[model samples]
Target: MTDTKNEQQWERTISFADGGTRLDKFWGRELADEGVSRGRVKAWIESGLAKVNGRVVDKGKYKLAAGEKTVIGAAEPEAGEGAPDPVRGRLDVLFEDAAMLMVCKPAGLTTHPAPGEPGPTLVNLLLHRWPDIAADKSGMDEQRPGIVHRLDKDTSGVMAVARTEAARLKLSADFAEHNVFKVYLALVHGVPTPAQGTVDAPMGRHPSQKTKMAVVDKGGREARSDYRVLWTGPRGLASLVAVRIHTGRTHQIRVHMAHIGHPLLGDAVYGPRESAEWERRPDLLAGLAPRQMLHAFYLSVFHPETGEPVTRWLPPPEDFCALLAGLPRECLRVGVVGMPGGGKSALMRFLGAMGRPCFSADECVAELYNPGGDGAAMINQRFGGAYTLEDGGVDKPGLFAAMRESDQVRREVNDMVHPMVRHRCEEFFKAHRDEPVAYAEVPLLLEGGWHKEGMVDLVAGVRCPADKRTGELRRLRNLPPEILAVFDSWQWPEKDKLAACDFVADNSAGLDHLEREAERLDAAALAALADRDRATEAWMDGLWPGLAGELDRERAGGEGPA
Candidate 1:
């Protein structure tokens, strides 16, 4: 093979062993090391680029004779009239082969230049890097060399481009025949009912707007899209959806989704004026979208040269993830409760050390008892300075004594301080909304009736050997044996506490074992959170139906957490 500035040339003489071989097969076998396919060789032969005995033989089926010199010449792609100019810019090349190029086009990049649009499109970037594709003008639009399909300028994801003339023809035909598979991810206004359905509609240019595409009743091209609800945001504010298109048309997804009254979030053209309405909702993220929330998440096609399947999948972009993070979601909230000396705080510290947010009602109450705190102010206002301290804080010891003397005083004090602690817990949850799991140490979780208040998603009760709990109480607090009995009487029995819990951990083992239990709890809590995440659940169902139940049964039948 000889390479020139404008063309590539290969010369060979037929051997007696290959005398009866077809011309195309001969070149294919000889150029096998060059990665040229037999189909591509046949095209070259039929295009008059192959010659035998110094005469052009445009028939790929021509039988070759021994000692006949054959030459196959192919032109290197070159810039032609009306070709796009090469522009240097950042290009995210995903996968590349001799026949095609798969690239991840970022949002805000035009796939190709058009009138009144702009330069420096994806085509220009391809021309700048893979200059050989410039002369492969076999696409429907000559200006879009090597481009077999396109994504909207503001839409982001994986795309495929043909790098050679033969590849261009093959890919174009594949797309025209709807042989390529495409799946898009999007955030829409509301969850589509029935969870999954298809939209078969005809699309064309809008009747009144010349630039926009819409569902038309007459003289429109056939378009169909299948969509499945991935997950719905809190309060039906928004939803993540997956859409698969059977026929590619201009703005097919946007128009179809809007036609069904579920316009994509941030689609200013086809969407309703819900952005203005969403401004009133501070918790919803629909008002934060800078552009349409649509992504070409996955694509699959047959290899232009090898005929094998090629696929690419791109994750959501930064902006898309930002909006997703802004959506209201529930983090796994686990409330750890047990007797005072049962290592509840130790477990919480272990969870905190592992990067999960841990909250303590006792710590919150301590903060509330600080000077000028809400709990102190409420006590002072309601008790007429009887329980007020010199620093304008509540006199906790005096208040407890008074509460022991009077049931009404105890009820009043509980009403004043419990709400404050609950408010602090709410603030902690809000601050750590992005975290996967959080822990709260509430020793009176069941006695105070907060366990049934739906404050936490899971309740974990810790139990220690009776002697261990008694020893810790004696050593830590120097409490009298009578006080220990009174403390035990204030809460439920150990067995009852365990029964009320969703899960339990034994603290009879030392702190090292307790730390390992915390690790186990961390995994279990996160797994529970993922199990509740509708998007993840829906995705798992789509990928491996019934696998979750199988895994659940396996875990259930296996040993308990170590």
Candidate 2:
């Protein structure tokens, strides 16, 4: 009649120093923890059942290194085989009374042994500290017999352990029936807009990324979260959120936020690149924060024996606070630039395709021209209605009339459009947090010397031969040689355009060639991204001091990002 299904847990250490051992490469390594076949270690990750340091450990090519810590993923805890002495572990006892126990677990401690547990776990320590605990272990499993639920190694929080089996069942029932309420404090990078929200994303393992989870609509468990905003920053956003979960899926919070375009401040595995505005900078998250900024801050439960409602609270750990305060200013700017007619518009369209915040210079111009004044009408006023159609549209004659009216008037039009162009361009950068880059279609990039200054990280050109360009122009307008000459003089030479470019894509080539060239440009972009990632990784190197999760970072230094 009560919730009776129990999920077992396992832990283990694997030897991989000989050369390089993949995280999933159990081909030769002893996976004694679960009797799980080495071949299936990769499958476990793919199925969303295996995790390393709490995130799915998905890669099969992760060469094993020496002294790497490994945790086994099983549905239930393995039965302890021997009557081992209690190994004393450091447990911050929150409240201990004759009827129940509460303790704060730090980041790196395990809930129970996957296997080969040497030190005394909280249960073992409690047993050693209280001899009567021996009586409490009568019907529990051999391994983690007393453990009810768990927090991942990186999640620091208050955990409850029962001194009696009956109390254990009742408490377990409380959790299963959703009678216990728990709250976590997370320091995520961006402030969630609207100051309050909920993310109802279903979580599953990433299709390709072994160590991450994706929010899939189908074939995944339903997870719900309620979050209230905390703060905002130039780097992106910073928020204090109260999280409530209906389903206890693996990485429910971390995965959901990342799915909605925000990752926690220090969750290296899921936090990096997912919503960190560093998808292009994989290495940026390499060593940035100490660990995931998830903390179990508040918990409410009813007393099993006394029927008293228990409420417990913990402050945000020091590490979480530090991470919230550590985001950088420059990392938040997105820049967009391109040579004139480089199809910066097309590129902007591409950015739009890639989910970038965008603004069109041409669109802005049209908006401005129509603001309380008719462009064709004003233009007609300068030239006359001869160019106007019956519908009041500016006649072609009107365009020439306005151009010849005064050089200053022409300058005025250009002035109106250019700054608005620049304004929107800057806004896009700020909003996107300075992604790889954005494009600004300035026809006179060379003359304006915009490329030499700011507005873009790389000044690139989209090109076609002069003859091809002229031929297209001729197709449109068979103007006098003098007219074409005037136009050509206004634009820079094709040779100069090519030379001035940081990157050049020959649109003169066929579509396939242009696509290939675009790929080349993308490669350059990825390389630039990588370099930025490396720098970020190096800057944050050696940041967290104490987390050795099953493995330590020092042992795996220079192995992740850089």
Candidate 3:
């Protein structure tokens, strides 16, 4: 009876005994297992889904000839005039098979056409691509033919739809039985205590606000949600939470989370637009939100035809990532670097006086070079007392002589000291991880490559003319010009360092000018620490050619369905 073994394809060969069979009547018997009517088969044939001997045959009454091949393309349901108009736009299909398909539903797009959201919905897009999804109308809503479940208009995530009536019934039953897996990511007001917990609440229509759902005590259905705090923003301003729902109800997540007093950020319906948490840094937390911050990050279901498990996961969209970027770090790490005698220490002192925690790399080196210290022992072992003093401390003058004489000596000494300095810096960061701001004065931050690493969030370079730097060193440390040259040779050119820095301060004009520059740099550094606009721009640029483009094309009236 079948010409092909592929389950996705339906083909039959006419036998001499079965000649003169009407196309529709033949298909009606052939697809009786699908429980579809002859009228449906007639529609499929007219739609050019049926072919005779590799040629399309639209007439249902066309008689089959002996030994002629009859093949049917994928079935598509006949659409009614009242049905949604098919709009040919790219759909984000995750997985598709003969019986079902999974797709990523973007936020701000309604799942299907409704009185409130008329036309141009996901269903319309689906119909254009898979007309057969509309084939089985038995007990199906004209507005929502193959849809099994839905995400809120403002909630984006993965969803599954059936391609056939049997598949639809099975999937619907699975969802109703709570056998499906669903996970969501929500940006909420504050971190929930105990880190993880469950919310068991009853939900019903709000008595006062008929348009909203709420946790009601009377005439409500059971709802349960489990959540874990994934990350907390600076100052406990906001938190990213992963939530799993055990029961599906209208606005169950929004209502349950709100009932627990940690409403989702930018949720104006259930959450107050004004709050102390938001008032602290509204721009970073909620002001940038285009809608309530909720994403259906993951979904798992069983295949209707094969009973195989199907799971799909999608990262949050561009806008969600942009909001995530807005969550500020707990501490703003500032790395100060410049040439010798460039007044880096002066800037460090200024920041310290302003109550910022400060760490000095030079001071860390000094401690390491102390008598019986790790640096002293390593130097004594490597050069065999060549750079060691009588008290087991580093002989600074001798070490400088060796460094000036041999390049290998200089590199070995530096290689050993850089990691120690970085370790101390890591310790400093850990100590001040809860602080708002911190400063690290690293003389060779750029030379040692610590600035580019994740050791610091921002780098500030202090620049001074060589002549001016020499005079300052002469006045302060009483160092000669030749020694300054050696220090300068070990570091990058002043201009190059300044070019790589996030911020720069000019110390050539003296302390009053340097102090003014420091003040400006401090303000700018703080702002940079809080700013997430750069990340948002990057995300938007990357998304414009992908998912964002699809939404734009649909809004601009994409081509009609083929």
Candidate 4:
């Protein structure tokens, strides 16, 4: 029979990379094994059910980095491989009694039975030694019998378990609120920017792509992290970072630090390119570190019953030191549609400055029709030298007439120029790998199938009321109103551009204002990045060693001899 009194305990190694996450979320997508979706993950975050390191993280998009030990409500699942037994050797009991028990959990033990996983986990050991402790929490989750928090499989840590239902509820509640404190030791790749500082950025789901966390500007929940540089390594290539989290998010540390261009060495997922960790440090996993160079060392929180601070300490697993020290982890083709002299050039210039790498339709045509540049010689052969400049440049007006009136000529021109333009763009993107954001501002971002390809982020039109636009156009180029109408007819309206752009800046303001707006955007981008890292640090440091030790004990016993 299920015990109505204090019954059950939760502990295990919890890695964000693991199938069942140590982190808890009322609404976010469950880990792959948990069988939840992004929408559900969102629900968890919004409802304040998701948390890391025992603090509320109401955002579904928060992350769980390696070496994180997260304590949550009773609903928290047993993430990762923890069969019920500590290593198949002797057990170390810190405290034991009929009402309760606490143990210094060895790394490498499974907490309970998982599907298709028939091995002795911590639960198996409990059943073998203390038959009366079984309370049957299988109804909550199949894998996790009775759980409060999880340590990663390789993180050695301590844990507490309730012998009765009342004890279980109270313990879970204590962890849910920040009544618990956890600490971790991470052998990171580089020293943190400041000797001691906090990371405070909101966490959110990655956009555009799925299956990861991102430091988002909008639609995220608060995350705070604090860290201090412990010491530089003998070689100075690495350092120890001591961290604490005011809030928890999944993969918070790894993602936040990576966003700032530094990835935890030996971490594959959420890290820099795979080449850095794989090719550069092929011997990493074999030497001193068996797992990632991270360890959860301490956890402290107010004891629910005693109303006093209770702290737990653990040590880094041998595997953590075995790994080699280093690990490295636009635009639519716009066709200009406008009256013959409708400030198209000026508009194009404005769009370009906004960080869009635009490809002007006018420019495309000119380049294509250049001598020896696809249509250059062809234009000369078809139209003669007078129309085609000596330098082999095409006459824009002349070429337009021919292409519009003669489909054959248009086809011929397209045949030569279209392919070349496409190739150039491909090369351009390859070279601009360092740019975080990219865009293209063409007069006709929508005219061609360019924007349809989902390449362009936005369409911005530098426009003014007809009277003002006409006057400006006339001053720039001597074109008649009648001629300009045909040109402008194809041009998209200002309202249309507004609807199309993800964001819009009214260049209608003075030049100084426009510059200010750009600066504002730049500042905002940097600020967001900074805030994200801070928040992640808070979550990272939240990984107290108390739970990590339990996880490490489970993993060592479960896996084959390493």
The candidate with the higher lDDT, 1 or 3, is 1
* Better model by lDDT: candidate 1 vs candidate 4: 1
Q: Give the Å shift of residue 52 in candidate 1.
A: 33
Off by over 4 Å in 1: 1-82, 136-142, 283-288, 328-562
Evaluate all candidate structures by whole-model CA lDDT and list the values in order. 0.76, 0.56, 0.75, 0.50
- Runs of candidate 2 with Cα error greater than 4 angstroms are 1-85, 115-131, 134-138, 204-214, 274-288, 327-562
* Window of ten residues with lowest summed lDDT in model 2: 543-552
TM-score for candidate 3: 0.50
Candidate 4, position 467, lDDT:
71
lDDT score, candidate 1, position 543: 38
Q: lDDT (0-100) at residue 321 of candidate 2?
A: 52
Model 2 global lDDT (CA atoms, 0 to 1): 0.56
lDDT tens readout by residue for model 1, 1-562: 1112334666554545667899988888766545567888988898887876445799988998754556786742222444567999998887898889899999999997554455678988988898877654433333566777789998999899988766866776576556777778888898788689999999876777856888978767679998988778754768888887888788899999999888987887888586555554434343578788999987778888887767667777889866865675557788888876778888988888898999999888887888988888888999898988999988987987787678798778888888788878877865665678878887777777777877788899898888888887467777767657655765788888888988788798888999998998888888888777766545534632243233234333632100
The TM-scores, one per candidate, come to 0.50, 0.46, 0.50, 0.41
Question: Model 1 clash tally?
Answer: 0
| Candidate 3 Cα misplacement greater than 4 A, ranges | 1-80, 135-139, 274-286, 329-562
The lDDT ranking, best first, is: 1, 3, 2, 4
True-structure lDDT of candidate 4: 0.50
Candidate 4 versus the native: TM-score?
0.41
